[model samples]
Target: MKYYNKLLLLACLSGALGACADDEIAAFKTDKPESIVEYEYLNAYDALKTYVDRTANPHFKLGTGVTESDFLSKGLVYSLVCANYDEVTAGNAMKYSSVVGNNGSMNFSTVRDLVKVAKGAGITIYGHTLCWHSQQNNKYLNGIIADKVVESEHPSEPTLDPSVISNGDFEDGTITGWGGWGNSSSRAISAAGQGHNGGHALKITNPTVGSDHYFVQTSYNVAFKSGETYQLSFYVKGASTGTGQVVAQDANYAGDPFLDKSANKDFAITTDWKLVEMKATVTADRTLILLNTGKYEGDLYIDDISLCHVNTGGGGGIVTNEYAVQSDFENGLDNWGGWGNSSTREVVDGGGYNGTKGFKVVNPTATNSWSAQVAYDFASELVAGETYYLKLKIKGSVAGNIGAGFQKKSDYSGRGDFPAMSVTTGWKEILTSVTVSGENADRFLFNVGAYAGTLWMDDIEIYREVKGNTIPLTPEEKADTLTYALENWIKGMMEATEGYVKVWDVVNEPMSDWPDPTQLKSDPNHTDTENFYWQDYLGKDYARVAIKLARKYGGDNQVLFINDYGLEGSGNAKCKGLINMIAYWESDGVTRIDGIGTQMHVTYSLDPVKQQANEAAVISMLELLAHTGKLIKISELDMGIADVSGTNIKTIAVTLEQHKMMAEYYKFIVKKYFEIIPAAQRYGITHWSPADSPDNQNSFWRKGEPIGLWNLDYNRKPAYAGFAEGLSGK
Candidate 1:
């Protein structure tokens, strides 16, 4: 993952230790032989903690992500943790799902236990997460909102009147299925509001006080199957403001409120009403779904509330009326996971065949496989054994293959790689006909993976044939519960500790791999059932919302940080990506991100040339983060000398020479942090592994390798001395 940050490189050349002239290097007193020997104090030993206390803010606690049992068991792990570090973070205990129980309940047993241990040692807990897309109870959070079934429902079986909402169009001259709520008043049937389908519509004359979102809605019972896919479609016109949002509440609306699957379609401004639709698989036998939107205290007319059972034809059949809005990219790339080693340009208008807006993707770097793509979640939308047509208007800088294939977000197997097509400079329709199957057909992927140039793509459409009007599919991420869930989780954590637990990794890994290291990760569509990619729901503004929530819940004095790995990677791609993200968040709106966490999960060898390169990257990465004017911290700092990077690791059986090399590398990085980053920007360092040997393989860094200042047996290694020297560069 090598990337060259031009601005960072320039800063390093002028200063950073690795690039300094011999005379400048000579100025570091600790590097002098006598000073090094003096700090050793004739072999007087100091814990890594002591060094941190002496040099970089003695009160500036060093932190690490640890397990609850390790500290609770009070094994060798606990002793080492207290001895070498002044702060602690639960690797998973403090996270969302781990602490959340049935419904949106809170269960902080592990966190409470860890907090006790930290309290005893005068250590504080660094809250791990309040917002994340993974490891969430997807079923619990997303499924909480169901169609609330009111008693006294007449027919128990499916009826010919397919309209889920009774009197949905208000053609009956009165509101029937419509449910007014929370200050919603002035409900009436408006003749002037005759819909695009030519009928009077239900109008909300006076909106709720804070109804900038979906407040008043239509709630009714639609008989649903436990495992069947369903969809909702309607025509909505914004109030006088020309904006509106359609929201769908869960069956348990009170328990999991504020979920809107059609958040994007909430605000399609036009006087003429347009059709909007969304797809979801029902989990419960029967439930109530609420359809509503918030307007600016004005009137909003609703018409043609209809629901249908969507048939996903993965078995290969004629298709029609697909989720066309998502394919069109008229608004922006929504629910589309964009990833690769290339730059994903903005969604530009006039780029598609229809001259509307289309997603512009470019291979900024001059390399093949400088790849990127936008993948859609077909989840239960595609039926088995159906012949489906995937079409997109595209003009490529180079001719290559683009597939509408099926693959998992993290481990895509490219099962749906269709026949390759060649397109010229002018926009052309690249169409593929594929018979759907139960193989790896989960997502509909549109890719430009290994192309060397730019690709302008838009107006994507999918269909085959339908005898009548095809049912439309627009994927909507009902985010009401998930968003509030994250907020509540953070609020709960803060309440538990009364804000004594001050710092946190508010957002993690908000950066992508190299080539376009300065951008968010675009590959690995996390739209799977197990993995809940937040970007899919919240988009790039995920960090901004997270930062704001932390500030609101944790109080004003909290130190919130954004953490990511590979920050010290070749060319500093990960680090650069984080800096760019922080900038985006701050400018996006009012946000409170305090520090930058460079999870220096690095690999290096005793090889001098390679080692030096690694050293330079570290300095430049730190310097670049410092340039952002935000607190710079080497969060989760660890280095593996293992063959994990194809270079054989110097495991426990390492020689004395190997030990010295390790010490030197540690010393170099710590000193560079202090030297390159100004005092104000220095957020201190956190050594990940206190002692090596518990279970390296499970750790993300070097699995099955030794990478700690203290040996597995708790004996201080040569690296300890090196760390001390670096921390206190006399």
Candidate 2:
């Protein structure tokens, strides 16, 4: 057997070597480690001791900011554990465990005492999650999943008077002839099976009574046994006229059927009450009996429920609850356009709103032209007394201003432009606030290529403010601004635009030999100085103070971003080290990096394989930071000269194809982003320059090279057409 294993290993090694040529195989062999070592196994306790000894060196550290020695001195750190109160017991003694029950009627004295003892012993505390599958209250569930429910033209009325039912009538276990369950009235039990009239179950004549409604009782042939478990189930239908509750209990017992003596799970009922089953441990059993208890004074229909032994060894598995789905348009989509001479604008894909296509702008001028105005009329009207945010995607033509505005028909002369409150260049998402006054208007006009450039816009949205009874803003809320700053620049920018510019990237891409700690320092006369303006004007705190001030005035939009480049390859180690320095600023609550801008400058000569790998690495790093739930954006994107030079016709074809590929890549990225990152964390993507113009000389102009979608004369390039095609897909 040993000889056979050796032969098999040799064959496998040969196959691996064949996969790589001789040169590669030689390199691999040289790089392989020469030594192999094994250690004796140790039990958990002894293993831990050995770990402590080995890591006991003064310099060894276990956690961030603290050393291993410091932690060892503190002994074992107890992690808090918590669970629903109903699930809590001596069986589970974690310090953070929780016990949940009736909201106002819950008894926490016992658990509180347990927690006190834990705290006294230096154990950490964390409640099992405050909310979970089994323990959530009705009120909490309603609030969490509440959506705007549309009401019907006419609602069903109740025929039975609620005053007729009484709790006393239900105590004797006698069935009343009240005909209300499965009825068509609010007084009738809703589909959820809860008593509608009152008393937690659907009541008949009296919403408060537990007896006026019809009751059900069933006697099982099997005798009850103590200390055994059983699964019980039953089906119930309420009269559309009223609501009621279905309760299973021991008909022989008097006091609360599900009190300490029995175990039961309560389910809410609505207009369409259906069958539900539950399993419980039989603490003390009497002959198993089931009852449909409520005061609807209506007939209660029961079906298909049974009681069985606990069968602990069976394969029923555990019951799992599901979470509510989240919305995609929480933040909002903003697309911008400006009309200029010879510029044209049209809607591409409406993005499912009206089921049309979004909008796009085409440049037709030889030297900076404009397009006609195009806009959208939202289906839902904005509330006059509420605040709404407006956002749009913009890709600039060449290097020109891209403006956006919100206005009423009166603000424009039918054929002219409205006043713009905000504007920016390159590809970016511009966000601003719009307030409606006097009357509500649904139409918004957009003008792209307003001056002399080509630009495209898509994903427009005007979001209404979130509503709730929580406090407007507090210290803790303000502190979240700092958190946002360390995440994405787009977030910081939006927050800054809302009020004051707090955090700012004073200088990006400083030249340095090796990895210098103070790369942000300014040197006016330094020959290799790269864009010294930011460093000269904004001190190191420039980014930090910008964030601080923005938080002070931007309400919840505080944070600032100091973005830079060179974070995609091994050659960019300095950039990574620089990012660490930025982290230090974040720790001090100054100059937090709302985002790290990776100027994706893809040169034509760049190895396609390496380029793809670099892009992957960049995306991976961004995702890591995004987990913090900060905003992220592709700050600038442009192809290098070497990426687009060749024969004129060949160059144009290659450029157009590359441009199309880039657009498709953008769509893939956006879709993947929405899938992985929370909607709240995505900022926007922007192009660095207009299609093909002097600004992007490397790819656009400058001899045989053609990069962007427009030429020096502002004529549409093949690239522009490709971009338009891509946006159409979205």
Candidate 3:
């Protein structure tokens, strides 16, 4: 795909052809002056002009290959190959075989229809093998073989001139046999046997005028198992009226007759060909013997022998069997944390954020009743020069004023609070934007108990807005609320980064893993807070709406992304459904989704080897997302060990070394991205937060388990330096 601006080419061509000479030169005539004659010569003048243009501008050229550097500069990673899928592998078809052979005919309409559908989808078609011994058997081959046998048999039959029958006896072993015609008998003997030899030959008898001259007897033996039934059918024709006895026995009989009554049968043959079917049941292991026992025979032809198993079972499994699983986290103590608990705020196996373990503030008399923040601080202290957006899920318990704010330490002595946004109870989600004023405001404090009614909060994300004006929110202020912040963040990032950040996730996991509201209301297993977020702000269109808004703000320069933590591949049903939803977004003229983010948070070592294995598994999951032709980023990566106090100094050293190795692994991933992803689609990697400093009071954070790249004193640690070096190709 060369990016050719066709209009530009036309414009340049039009400008170059503007000038022309009006005078015509006479053919085969020299001008008065040689210089004028040469000037009038078209080739000579054009060659001179070309030389002058080449000398004046050397860079003018046509058609060149795009270099790797040029591709990278244009953000193209050409290393990864696009995936290919055929109809069978796509697993969306209802039938696998087009020919059923139900009525002994082949039809390809079903297969042709499937191919048509696949072609429309831009999917490749793989033609299966033309011949396979296992699927195609002797029945198909027998029809073809019988026709050849019949054709060969007809040409070799005995024929008599009118004088031979009147003058001689065809059966006599004398008279030179109708052309010394015993010679004809000799040739017939050779052709009828298994090999070209004078043994086991066909015998002809009787010669009469206007009657069949002789009888031809030929036999074939085929082995059969005891107690098996075989059906034999063939086409037969004769040159004249003939009575033929088809006999089956174990072996060839010269003078003796077929003793078994069931083994021999007689049939009349006409001049025209007709099909004959013979069915036999063998009591014991025997050989099939076919004998023609007619006294008068002109020439007999046989074709099409077929045999098949009579009592076969029905065809195996149906192709329509489909398997699927759906889960809505209704069981007791499901992986989804119930709402209203401090520890439940973190995301669980179920789709929704666990809010049950966190503080639940419901209808408090005072302004600040239920305010709980995470144990960790922001990666950097918020400065007055920067802007930040506070994103949280809030479910209004009763219609009342709800306020959310972030507090940062001022003057290194105490904390000062700023309001992000306020919302009224309508059972909806409210997003608030808060800007910090004054110096050194880094830490965040969340407050939700003003004018008290119950409110639920989960996934409180505080990110620095790349660009935007953060005006102070007074008591009388009214704005677009959280939706405005999201839009502003998108626009601001585009403006500040100057389109460097081509990818931005519009929204994270918006689906709740909790039980359905209809079921939760009646079932004891269901919890109220579990469905709060879904019941409130989001409804069903949260993901879709957020994506639309983000795209609107991102403009054409940035690629919008809809990110989630867990759904890595097709195996994860939630993830798969989310993918389907993203596809829906794509169908709505939104092609900006460029990637997915998987948060790889390791809280326990499990063991050194196991930890590494788990990390590899995480990478594999992310690779699956990468396979979607979307950029994959490990959004959040933090590791912690349970027993930090028990860990010896050597253990801590080993842990730090392991962390460093992980950093190196991240570097390896970057290189692999360049190798595996196309230069045009390769988006640079980013860590969730810059630091992982543990809180001293948290039990999980104890025992010198170094998680972050920075210490509490705000100094850079080994992991940070290692990461910087790794990214720098050191």
lDDT of 2 by residue, 25-92 (tens): 75554322221110001011111112212222222111111111222233321110111001111212
- For each candidate in turn, the TM-score is 0.54, 0.26, 0.28
Clashes per prediction? 43, 116, 36
- What lDDT does candidate 3 reach at residue 328? 26
Candidate 3's residue-wise lDDT over 1-730, tens digit each? 2211234344446545543423342222322445223222221111111221233323211111112232223222111101111112111111112242432344444444544443454433222211111133234322222211111212222211111011111111122211212112211321322211211212333233222211334444445566655555545555677665544455433222232235545565676756666655666666544444335434444432233323221222111111111112233222222222232233224333342332334443434423433222444556564444445544445533433434454433323344333332322233334446556665554444344445454444555532112223321221223334334433443343333333444555433334421110121221332221211222344455555654565455554555454443223444455556666656767455666555444444436665465456555554556567765544444444433343323223544445555555544543444345444344444343233444456424233555554444323344444444434444
lDDT of residue 314 for candidate 3: 22
For each candidate, the alpha-carbon lDDT, in order, equals 0.63, 0.38, 0.38
Scored by TM-score, the top model is: 1
29 Cα displacement, candidate 1 (Å): 45
List candidate 2 segments past 4 Å from native. 1-542, 549-556, 569-575, 590-593, 604-606, 641-677, 695-707, 710-730
Write candidate 1's Cα lDDT for 350-459 as tens digits: 87676888777775554343146656775454555665666667887754444446554456655444444444465655555555655545676655665656778886
